[model samples]
Target: MSTGPAGHVARSTIRPHSETGVEGRKGPLRTFLSTWDGVRIDSVYEPGAVVYEESGTRSGRPGSPSGRDGLVFVVAHGFTGDADRPHVRRVARVLAGYGAVVTFSFRGHGASGGRSTVGDREVLDLAAVVDWARGLGHTRVAVVGFSMGGSVVLRYAALSRVGGGAGTGGGEVLGAGVDAVVSVSAPARWYYRGTAPMRRLHWLVTRPAGRLVGRYGLRTRIHHRDWDPVPLSPVEAVPRIAPTPLLIVHGDRDGYFPLDHPRMLAAAAGEHGELWVEPDMGHAENAAPEALLRRIGEWVVGRAG
Candidate 1:
């Protein structure tokens, strides 16, 4: 356990059993750590529990591989979201049904330090969380991100393959590589403010008065500088994620980003990726239905295992 800025206590622990002990239920271990760039990140680890044991292997889809022993999911929340948000927790809980789960808050959101560079600098935060998951003894790690986080996961997966020292702040070490990636409701390009919600979001990050609201009201601090060389767009990063399984999920009814966004990403991903155009779903984590989330969980378990 350690103390972070503003006296936030970050601790890591693994419990063997829950108080109720509902047969095979287990507890989650949480910790707070810093990225290579020195940004604090709040994280949680949910140990895989045995929902049903049969023939020395857990049950799963017929003809599919069983025994999800080493799979772990690192879930990154959308804009204005954190590890503790109900929607984030819901996604974590669903993923936890299959294997271990890791959920975290990006810097400038929740209790972490530094300002949100939106999707640009958030890749470092996901890298750090993935590193921590690897350190926790999980051999196969998958990254799942929503909205802004969706873009971050795509970029992280792409950047991580270009060797080890690109985005980790000047010679700093790179985190472990991700085995699978799931991006929900992400933008293919940058500076998109076509929808009302996105226009409002743009105002929140670009305007001084809106940034004040972001800092105090939303608990998210916005960085003022523009992208120096213009970070890779999600579409540009998708092709680089090849050989590694990629899943791009978006809602047909999403008001924030239209179908064109996911379509663009899926096209760039080529044969290495799968696309799910959800029916009647809205935006990001909040709008994702439980059924859709379960499908996503199943997808991660199948691929990451």
Candidate 2:
């Protein structure tokens, strides 16, 4: 691993053993980058693959869009999850099979620094990662976020179009935009502690004791201040993401946000959005089957690639 001047770290090669006969000739280059807020984010980048058919024509893997270059997917994990989490890695692996993949730790999760703003301010983290992906030569970038991260992706897409920037510790502002988006199990509005998991999550983010638990027990730091200006909600942000293709995926059995949340987001998305209410599914990345994730990868490749 080598460290850049900005304290960015490039870890493992996306694919270390080309001699092993992997389908793709190359894989993503893994690295770390800092958010505008001075938060160091752990990130990975997978290189796109090309397969040649018997007709001597080049194409991507099945479920992937053909004849595209520099296609990339930026994956965001749920609250209490990090870049290295098993579920996050699973999603990344599936997406990587289609094209390049960039997965990162949101601030206050995994090896990243800074307290969790829940959905607010986390946009900076996503923006920084997206910027890094673009810098790595990805012509098309799509973002996939789950749960709290899902909400952040929705807001990020909306805010990016309006020149919204995240606050740095210094006076500088950083802005990053994306071409496509996928939100899974995201809440439409805030402060709805209806389900048991959400009620517990509310306590984890709201109470002092809960913050302490989050800090030590969960390794997630909760920001002390509440949203003063109250950032835009997911449903509200949906309309703003017009022309940017959107896919809202939620499990029919989701206990946290319920079916109404995805429905609300889909309704707000209007013509540009598609909704997948998966049967027998539960919540977030943990419950998303590999088949479902591959389908998501296909959607991203078809739209963004």
Candidate 3:
């Protein structure tokens, strides 16, 4: 593990190997899903120990709490992260304690076929996974995203409400809607180069040599084209996500966007959103502690109603 841009530890592609994945009763359910733009996404479904029975129905275990039944959490990883990333699997395992979790690789990451669009069109990748979660009989769905993914979830939720779950290129985005949304270590606006890490990240995304490094060194594929028309920023999308439970989490010591980012999102959220300013924390999922993840799981169970 290497020290992240700020204070926290950021595990690049070179980290100690962790367990293969979190396994359900029948083992990890893995598959490929197609996004609205026809990009194939690699997805994994892990059932909560207390959430689902062998038949995929609610277990109703003796001490299981209410509101957990039929609930599914769709986890969206940060840039260069895929469903199988050790950090992502750790998050899935913790969230699975409360409900089933559906995690997927965006267009250009993991085994999925396509190049990364950074954050612009990744909404389609999330939409495909959310729809798949619904198809699995989950009545309540919550989306949890980190970093770049955080931006995508915000945009996705807003688009779901405003566009009625519509997709581009004539592809029907029937499953784009979600019941709850969580954005962690996300930026409020786009094109922010306020920090060193972000500046390096921008270089990695915009330059040809950077793309090569992302592909060979980081095992992530990035698209060369830029966003034709910049999508709505996270702050702009927050107000539109109202009526749906939205949670914005940021660390006081975050390396990327400072406290202003989350604060901006909270201000936009008004009464419709909740914010958690973590103490002594750094950046995205790599820095999110297990206890915090559990608290987030609890929030999902309680709010996804």
Positional deviation of residue 211's Cα in model 3 after best superposition, in angstroms: 0.6
Per-candidate clashes, comma-separated: 0, 3, 0
TM-score of each: 0.84, 0.83, 0.84
Best by lDDT: 3
lDDT scores in order: 0.77, 0.76, 0.79
Write the residue-wise lDDT of candidate 3 on 155-208 in tens digits. 888767423543321333334488889999999999999999999999999999
lDDT of 1 by residue, 102-155 (tens): 888898899777888888778778877876777666667889999999999998
Residue by residue across 1-305, what tens digits does model 2's lDDT show? 11112332212122111132222336545556776556677776655554334463446653232336566788989999998899998888887766777788888888787788898878878878877766565667899999999998998787664234332223233355778899999999999988999999999998999999999998898888877767778998889788888999999999998898999999999888999999999999999999999899878767866
Off by over 4 Å in 3: 1-25, 52-68, 162-176
Instruction: Score residue 26 of candidate 3 by CA lDDT.
Output: 42
For candidate 2, the per-residue lDDT at 301 reads 67
Q: Residue 151: error of model 2 in Å?
A: 0.6
lDDT of 1 at 69: 65
Cα shift from native, residue 145, model 1 (Å): 0.5
Candidate 1 versus truth, CA RMSD in Å, comes to: 6.9
